[model samples]
Target: MQDQPLNAADFDAIESTLLKYGDDHSVLNPSELDGYFTALVSSPEQVDIAEWFPGIWGGQNPAWETPDEAKQFIELSVRHINTLARQLAEDSAAFAPRFEQTEHLGHDVTLAEEWCFGYLRGVAVANWTPLPAIQATLLQAISDCAEQDNFELPQDLDVVAHQQRVAAIAPAVRALHDYWLSQR
Candidate 1:
């Protein structure tokens, strides 16, 4: 809500850069980064960039492959996501979490899971507080969602149900935010 507004153009280049270099090294996509940022800073506790960056960039293949521009992307993304957290906390109707995926998938598994994983990693690095029951449950749900089990989808599994589960990220983020705030 300051001089810079959270928008796509600021991060659009990162995706293109990832396409050029590849996103395999990166644990999170642009969209997940945004969600993760909100999850971290939305809390009352201040999350240091030093603490969170390693979790975000760790395990990335071609470890040093990230260009300067990519680093800038994270900086800009933090700013944008901070703004997003403010909006969400204020119950702004215009707040919509951004996703890096261009096309929709029949089963968008990674969308919420990666974002949650990023959030989990951030929380791990901060280690400032313990999670309440709801937060713990959501984290478990996301972990389940992220699993890449080599098995067929249940024939009767409802697509709507799965989508609903994935769609819970925003609310879950809000809950975590409130939890941390209350602790503070």
Candidate 2:
């Protein structure tokens, strides 16, 4: 699916069951997606990229509450997408392309919806596609793999290749990226 703005309703539905802390937008800022990679590279050095969130056990108490839950949300989204990737790689032949970007890969809306709004919501409220662009890419790639019965994601692949796979899966990634930048 192409990148689109998630209105208040989408956010409301996601945060509906979760306990409200402070301003939900601050806790679930879309800008985190851009800052995440920078934070990963600048470890040990302090940055403004931080937020309060729940505890390790999924508890969101008063004292231990994290200021931002972006990291948790990204991790959850990544795990969901990676699982699909591994599955596609394991059975490469059974997959097929879903997006027109690549020969076989195509967009996978179900994977995107499930991971973005479903699994990610389990931990903290997320702003939908604003966070899961990377995950969405992976899910699309997995969908492509599914089209072919002999498709398999390479095990020894590096991060760049993984990114290429994601890019190929979703042409909308650029739109998503631009939307993310607009959110900043």
Candidate 3:
């Protein structure tokens, strides 16, 4: 397993591959993929790759042009999964969701909607259920961000509120990881 962390170039390659083969499917981008993998790793119950891999391409596997292309995708994804698992286990603070950077009201802001949505997707795939009240609340923080549609902020949500929810996601995820770790 190529456990070296994926650099920018690797992410670009993954993004390019998704765009090239995604067609009309709702394929996850690099940032979304990271969150998805994080949730899968943090899941209390182990999820098999055979079950979750298809979810990346929106319930179907992409048809790569060559065997090597498929191989590279699998390698990168497995490496990322392992990296997240290791980070969450060794140093939960080191685990950060890959959020997209953008400008909001003339200030630089990081948006986590896509990443949060991907995480929720993983949770659904893992069939996570019956959580204790505290852990449920932690997961709800990520859910708050996930509920927003792309580029469509809720009318009732001011910038401050939105930023607060986004800020809470990382800590909530870390706590969730810790909760599951303690269970094991």
Candidate 4:
């Protein structure tokens, strides 16, 4: 099951389940989880499931309502991880980070903070070494978005600037993935 890509129903189930549990736990939401998995898949060194699985619930396993529920969650998560790896390997252009969408100043914008944070979390879990200067610059782009305060935006930030910064993330991600692939 981990080798198979999740269908729409499976994806929806994973998202809904995370939301259901997120109320009382620190579990990653769908978009954040997607980013987290992306980082793991793109890392030059592979991370073991045991090391990163606990990150889904912020370092603790949830007391699932049933064994089957836990099984399903694990299965879906593994499948998603595999799917990310396959996408990045076969068609990097098809890769898209999951982001929350909302209107800011009457302009549609993507909220990448959580997703970026999740990616950073995965980076930490992977214990990556110092990247080359160019790769480091690409990573800095992601770090900037992740470091934004949850409630406060920079005073000078305009909608267009924000969109431009968000737009850079995908290309940066693709480049970073390529860099890591070359390293491997």
Which structure among the candidates has the greatest TM-score?
Answer: 3
Write the residue-wise lDDT of candidate 2 on 139-173 in tens digits. 34534533432233334434354446434533333
What tens digits encode model 3's per-residue C-alpha lDDT throughout 123-178? 88888877999899999888887777748544454777667778899999998888
Clashes of 3: 0
Model 2, residue 157: distance off in Å is: 14
Per-residue alpha-carbon lDDT of candidate 1 for residues 73-156, written as tens digits (9 for 90 to 100): 566766765677677667745555563232233554324555555566556656746566878886666556556231345555
Q: What is the Cα-based TM-score of model 2?
A: 0.21
Local error of candidate 2 at residue 57 (angstroms): 5.3
lDDT over C-alpha atoms for residue 52 of model 2: 19
**Candidate 4 residue-wise lDDT, 1-184, digit = tens:** 5788878799789888788776443545777888889999989899999988887777777788999998998899999999999999999899889888876555677889988988988888888889999999999999999987645555466878788998899899999999999999
Model 4 bad stretches (over 4 Å): 1-4, 23-25, 150-157
C-alpha RMSD in Å of predicted model 4 compared with the true structure: 2.3
Off by over 4 Å in 1: 1-3, 17-25, 59-71, 92-95, 99-110, 148-157
Model 3 TM: 0.92
> How many residue pairs clash in model 2?
31
Candidate 3 backbone collisions, by pair: none
Give all TM-scores, in the order shown. Answer: 0.69, 0.21, 0.92, 0.89
Better of 1 and 4 by TM-score: 4
Backbone clashes, each candidate = 2, 31, 0, 0
Q: Which pairs clash inside model 1?
A: 25-60, 25-61
Better of 2 and 4 by lDDT: 4
In model 3, the Cα lDDT at residue 48 comes to: 97
Candidate 3, run of 10 with poorest lDDT: 149-158
